[model samples]
Target chain A: MAPLRDPALEEISEALHAAPGAETITRLSAIDAVRARILLAIEHRLYAPGEQLPPLEALAEGLDVAPITARRALETLVEDGALVRRRGRGGGTFVAASPPQIQDSAVNVFRADEDAIRLLIDQRCLMESALVAAAAERITVEECDDLEALVDAAEQATTWAAFHSADRRFHRRCAELSGLVEATSYQTTYEMLARYFLPYPLDRLGGSHREHRAIVEALRAGDGSRAATTTREHVGSLRRDMFMALPR
Target chain B: MAPLRDPALEEISEALHAAPGAETITRLSAIDAVRARILLAIEHRLYAPGEQLPPLEALAEGLDVAPITARRALETLVEDGALVRRRGRGGGTFVAASPPQIQDSAVNVFRADEDAIRLLIDQRCLMESALVAAAAERITVEECDDLEALVDAAEQATTWAAFHSADRRFHRRCAELSGLVEATSYQTTYEMLARYFLPYPLDRLGGSHREHRAIVEALRAGDGSRAATTTREHVGSLRRDMFMALPR
Candidate 1:
């Protein structure tokens, strides 16, 4: 929920490391994979602050890892302030209400693969197009108005994290409006792609806000075909208009 | 995997129980939910036959179930002949290489939810369309030949299980041809919907083999749009054609 580091500082860091469409990191080690998965779950709010993680044995099983490996992942996360361990009765490891914004590099795992990035983009386009078409058919006037309000909120958001939170809600609303059960898969795909996203400046995010409004207009008119086109244009522009699509 | 029950008899059973589009069962109990998850994992081949399963503590953790509850689910699965146990060295509960085919009703859990079925279908449509389109862009003639062979294999399959096996491979090939790293997500989405699939007659399956050939033709011609359209029409027809659409 906080910036990974100072915005200007991080941008400069990213620019320095820019490799231009090359593999950004080596393949993830298994321990790093586990650590990243748990971190993602926290960011995804699967484990809310104050929520207890499953016991280490269970966590290991869930992750299909050895108990010692799971223990090591927990130790690193706790040390970085992402998780906490409490002992004695009625106590266990818990997500830190304020997980330290340490310079943990585990979350960088997703950007390592060129093929995954391409696949996710293609997958997102397909799912987003389908969802937007469906939403145009079913979204109510009230829902459209609520969507506009979300757009306004994002435009006014003060921080990268706040913008991100609203951005997720806005896209999730598009999927939900489709009134389809499998819309949940859209979120899963979206999150996987989002992991590859580096932070964007607020003003650049504001540029994207216009496309969001255009999508709402198409939905309000109940034009599925137009909405789908508008949606594709929006997603396609993601690589160019904002976010990381460069050699970084 | 063994047939869920007597093949001929189950077909007749399916006919009698068919409601044409109604929810046939109540909501899944949590234990049944866990049971279904494990069964699906087996069917997906994540845990191979004769492979040892995680210990109770780990399995429970992985499933987010209490140890007692996880035990009950495993017990029911074992009783149904889907799993087995052996004592002593390297011994734990294992998937029965020749697990007995029992009329265990837990596999029916997925069909209980109308929304989930529809969602899975929608989600599949999006992902499959994307994968097929990407496949057309990248498939080599040799890969196309391999796909044609899989289609042929499905045509020759004598049992529903055999057809199902080839069917999985054929679709998986579509994703793999794209050479996209996240193509694995396609398999995940496919298996989730497959959990809701009812067995179709082999002849009925044979009738659907035509579409597979059409898809291959489009891919071989390097026609991405055509391949994608053919894929959509093929998936769309699933509701009315080969698979379940009636309220049973």
Candidate 2:
């Protein structure tokens, strides 16, 4: 697969080239630039997820900068969710998931699970309601097929983990149907973290799948409020279940 | 001010110490472990915001590991939004922010502008309603003071920027009071981004301050629905104002 490049890479590279800093060119300023480069590097698959990063010496050499400069640059990427570091024997650098496609990028950079997964689900519930409402108002014919297939996958899955994965795909599909792909990163972060905090059992999947069908039906009939309400319950139930299962 | 430390630093240090081999950990595995370290570091201010990081060699030496191992550990911290780096001259690593403190952390992570900010505010409206409802059912006296003070700050502000700053504090305080500090990051992210992208003229301060008073009164009265509704309008107006300033 072609590696993805960060949307911000070209802008920074261009800025770096355009900057008239003959003396200070070797120094780094604005940690965002370093982060942008790392993100771009990851997107390009120059550094694959779970793959160790080049030694700080190598990276500094490649970027034509100092080891501390390279080290700090990598550290910024770590802060931005583009890189991960390990310590101890055999520990090395690796890529994390691509930074979420953000529609609103002005907010402070979120470290994954900083808000934890539960809070992300709560936000997802809010966004899902709006997404369903939007999909009800304007879901394409092809999109309906996609949604059906996701639901079908969920129903066919026998294991809890598989069903949970399908459930995530189904909701993600719904969000995409609403034409909000750029906003998925915020929600995706939550779901990914939620995996660590609350793993769902397979038996809890049936009811939500049935509810998904109802939401689809509501969308088919152009009943936006109904579709939105149903979608809210569907996603909210996931949060509710996790909350109930919270270690007492 | 002393920089905030991430909360997971010590745990990660321990984990790294306990790991058995040189095999690189799995993607999420290393990501989560390093993430814990970054957070703990932030909590402890080991990596202060805007401060340069030690050279990669130094980190490796301190951790008693290979330079390659140190690279991986730092890489993960970058991805987790706990650090920022620069390259060339005058650049190194710096801590990003401590969690549970909203604006600084959330704003840097997400970008919220006019169109995107509107959607986020709308999302906030939904969450605020639910949060306030939950708070009404369960909130403390000390939390109430924090909420009230935020409103007072908003009312006393003289500039639109100052008012907006106080306004954010008010809403975030409400979220904190709701005892869902975890869920409030999204809202905090929105508020912080809005402050940056939707700066108002200095003249518009009073109107927002008035809205602040009304929302606070509602919360003070234990009127969850009223607090929810009023807060929605308050945020919705900011969104509307921002959209009005947009081209086309």
Point to the candidate with the largest lDDT: 1
By summed lDDT, which 10 consecutive residues of candidate 1 chain A come out lowest?
A8-17
Compute the interface RMSD for candidate 1.
19.1
Q: Indicate the worst ten consecutive residues by lDDT in candidate 2 chain A.
A: A104-113
Candidate 1 lDDT, tens digit per residue, A92-208?
999999765444465554333433445456567768866777678678999999999998887887655566777888999898887754467677557655645543435556557
Candidate 2, residues A1-248: lDDT per residue as tens digits? 12223232222122222212222222225344345445544444445566666666655543444678768767766766667888899887777755543221211122222323344566766556656665666787777877888888878875544566676677767766765433354353334333232223345456888998998788778766667568667766755454333332
Distance from true location, Cα of A86 in model 2, Å? 34
Model 2 CA lDDT for position A154: 79
Give residue B240's lDDT in candidate 1 (0 to 100). Answer: 57
- Please identify model 2 stretches exceeding 4 Å from their true place: A1-115, A140-142, A197-201, A243-248, B1-158, B165-186, B191-200, B203-248
* lDDT of each candidate versus the true structure: 0.66, 0.52
Model 2 alpha-carbon miss at residue B227, Å: 16
Evaluated at residue A112, the lDDT of candidate 1 is 36
Q: What share of the true interface contacts does each candidate keep?
A: 0.15, 0.07
Clashes of each: 14, 66
